[model samples]
Target: MDIVSVALKRYSTKAFDATKKLTAGEAEQLKTLLQYSPSSTNSQPWHFIVASTDEGKARVAKAASGTYVFNERKILDASHVVVFCAKTAMDDAGCSAWWIRKRPMAVSPPRTQKPLTTRVALSLPICTAKS
Candidate 1:
């Protein structure tokens, strides 16, 4: 409904069911949501790594070691774990490349696109599931 309502309903998952798993469709929906999420000035300067399998989750859980160990079980038990990464910097060429990859048919002439590309930054998130 409203922003406040949505925010009020939001919560953090303290525990996850290790016996459960996400369906292919559910996983795809999550990926699509991540792909289209809004960003400041549409400068999507981030990537997402989603892990679903035991092995994949294990690998992802590695990042939660030591001081972050408290999150290891949650990550390993969840149906999916998403790691978000942001690029430190991006240039015009990088932005244009992303545009071409995302919307090949919409690309205009290089000369006409240069100015627009210069003002944009891009980030692509790759999804992987290992079995």
Candidate 2:
């Protein structure tokens, strides 16, 4: 089947089949599929902390304004809980400009070893892996 067709068939199922918890093999299969999902510059910055315990799921739910009925209820029943986070050097986009302005200017003799300007370097691929 085509990519669009495959994606269309896949649904965001919050309500799960409570009768069964995903097997290890089934979970791994899902992980493999999730890993292939589109990422910026192939930067797959996702980590899975599978919460199989009631307490773990409870904490996750509590963290979300204490009404984590979804996570608390479904996460425990689900196969895994994937935590997605992206590494960033700045707190916000505005900080990027301040970062560039800090660079020293050329004084008569142009330094040949100067690193690339920040704007040009943004073209580099995004960080895909942590550490």
lDDT of each residue in 28-110, candidate 1, tens digit only = 99999999998764557789999888899999989898899999999989999999998766555666666665676874657
Error of 1 at 8 (Å): 2.3
Q: Which lDDT values do the candidates have, in the order given? A: 0.75, 0.52
Off by over 4 Å in 1: 98-131
User: What's model 2's TM-score?
Assistant: 0.52
Measured by lDDT, the strongest candidate is: 1
Runs of candidate 2 with Cα error greater than 4 angstroms are 34-38, 66-71, 90-113, 116-121, 124-131
Error of 1 at 131 (Å): 47
Please provide, for model 2 over 1-131, each residue's C-alpha lDDT reduced to its tens digit, 9 standing for 90 to 100.
59999988987777666566778888888778876776553434345555545666665656555555546566655545555555443322423333344443623324553333333235324312121
- Clashing pairs in model 2? 43-128
**What TM-score does prediction 1 earn?**
0.71
